[model samples]
Target: MTPKEAIRLAINGRTDIGQVRDENEDHIGWYNHPSLPMGFVVIADGMGGYTGGSKASQIAVKCVTEHLETLPTSTFQACTPDQQLLVIHSKILDALNAANAGILDAKVSAPQLANMGSTIVLALVWQDKVTIAHLGDSRAYLWNKDGLCQLTSDHSLVQEMIDSGSLTVTQARSSRVRNHITRALGVTEFIEPNINTYALIQNSLLMLCSDGLTEYLDHGELEFVLSTHRPALECCYRFISEANEMGGKDNISVGIIEYTLENKVSVSQANISVPAPSSAPVEDVTVRKESRA
Candidate 1:
């Protein structure tokens, strides 16, 4: 039997407009196919002014989800598991490209929204593996008994500074330009998303969140929460509440996926190999504490 047929997943998501923001510009969503062993979680953080920010994020989430839903599932299922992963990665990039175009088109129709843009992080899970994709500073993380590992890199000015050895983690956290992102959807004609795949170990958790939660909590704090073994929904609320307690200066969004092997099958020890997308060159930044304005 396929790994997807042998496992179960519990998913939950949450978004909050923190103490300082007058409007919530972050969006989170998840979709699980009824028949196929496939699902996805998406989070977007918008930028620009009040109206533009909200609209841009909403549009990005909607467009990406819609595009992904249209992929040929049966075609993908016919390929080997490794090949299926590549197809999924390609489709995710296609979705992001479509979303970028949709946002750019919205800007043309509404001149005032010219400055609108957004950061997006998405996780597409198929049976025992997951494909994670992202643009800008939003992130994806994996947590298990071993601890928490950040999977996606931040595409931000502060990250660039740290990568160049010009700024230390302590310095970047408080830097005035810490929130300035180097890449975002709709900011340019095209975007190169960082995509990767990983094995979804049984009893492990996958998290996707905007900078809001990361702004307040570090990796140690995140590990503590996941170690509690609470339900995925409870973890989502805890993350949002903790971020708010820590000065909630921006919008917060999170999506959690918990994987479990059912009684029918034993855990597989195979590793899923994911090749980098060939569309554009993407820089891989080391994980760090990131802040948002």
Candidate 2:
């Protein structure tokens, strides 16, 4: 078997009500099927008021989990690697769409939840690869010996402003419109998520989280926590605790996955340094736009 097919993964997840939030609207999930070589980790941040927001996030998690659980393992295993990736990508999109429709239907049936919405980030792992899909601002980060890098971009207005050169990163962070998101599930009839696949580096780590943790931690802080060489579950707890200590403005949810080869190679640590914010204005970053089917 190829190295890609001979990999194993360790995963752990946690969610907490921050110091300020009365109820936690963030939901996290990780599942490894007994019969398949695939697994997934998901994080969702609910929007709107407490009742609507929590319900929206819960529904999104449930729908995605059920969809993945019911996928036919035999059919997936029959495909080539490339074909398998495409199938997984399609299923991710379908699952998101299904959740969107379900949320919309719920809003229609219950007038009180009319404004409910959610941001979702998911990572699907199989063999030595990970397929990431996301909507709105929930994020995914990759960490290895090279340090940590954000794999998913935020769909928030502040992020757009920063990318377009209209606002600096420092300015965007404190902007009044920082929380305004351009894309979300359950807010409309349809949603288009950004999806990408990457080959997993042995002894590397992947983190999926809500904005709550990111709102308090910067790139350097995140790198520090992830590079501690701790167990996946410990890492999840540490991230949540640190976020809360930093003011914990929102509900925090974190999911961590550690990928390793059969031989258990060790990952080296790097002296991480934060880059200074760019002085020159940046051009607008183009996103892969999608329309409803």
Candidate 3:
């Protein structure tokens, strides 16, 4: 049986031009594979001038998805979680190199595509495990009983400053170089992706979004919506809408995945029967207490 008929998942994705741009260079997509505990979803935000940016993001998404599709199922089942993660780490670096080469070849004669690059954040749901591979500033968040936890650290200049103790979390948020990404696909032939694997629990929700969403919503807001919401699709839409309502200055894209005891959740049909968040805003900014390495 196909994944559609075997395991059930709810997915809703949207990309907006936002309040700042005439074109949307962000892309998000989910692919459900049959006969495996694997689900692939990716979100890419391109950075370049016009067509170059859009094309670079599209290429990154396509390359990663295609590479995953061609990978043997034995790869996932053949090793421990840590070993699998290492293999995935190697694959991401290899794929980024290939993508960079492709982008360079495409831009050899066209100056418009010369300096194009993209931030890639990929999530793989396999059985009870959530594997995340990320570069640039896009992020992954997990929502459970403990609330929302950021699964990846951004590869940006501000992040570097924070690491060096040159900037505080509050200062990094409003830093001039906050948007300046330090790592991305196609910018360099050698790229390193931070890879992690989490043991997912039943009735958990995983969210993947570009920086556009985080630019507005705080962790408390995310926890409220994700933990309280029943339908995954609505949560995804509300996220994008809220981002736009709060002055979306860049392209926005979001993808959601909800885990269950059995594959019973329907994608088109959502169970909209959950309690709402408290009528309060969570604007508290907490200090960073975790190390990136």
- lDDT tens string, model 1, 1-293? 34556677777899999999999999988887776657789999999997998898999899888977766566776898668767787677777877788888889999999999999999988877787888888988877766677877788898878878899777877899989999888887757777777766556788889999988887778878988847655899999999999999999999998776775556563665332322112344322212111
lDDT of 3 by residue, 25-139 (tens): 8887787665555676789999887888898888888877777765446756678655666666556556556665666666676776888889988887765566677779998
Identify the candidate with maximal lDDT.
1
Candidate 3: worst-modelled 10 consecutive residues by lDDT = 284-293
Winner on lDDT between 1 and 2 is 1
Weakest lDDT window of 10 consecutive positions for candidate 2: 268-277
Q: Output the TM-score of candidate 3.
A: 0.80
What is the alpha-carbon lDDT of model 1 when measured against the actual structure? Answer: 0.79
Steric clash pairs (candidate 3): none
Model 2 scores what on Cα lDDT? 0.79
Q: Give the Å error, residue 160, model 3.
A: 1.7
Order the candidates by lDDT, highest first: 1, 2, 3
TM-scores for all predictions: 0.89, 0.88, 0.80
lDDT of each: 0.79, 0.79, 0.71
Better of 2 and 3 by TM-score: 2
What TM-score number comes out for model 2?
0.88
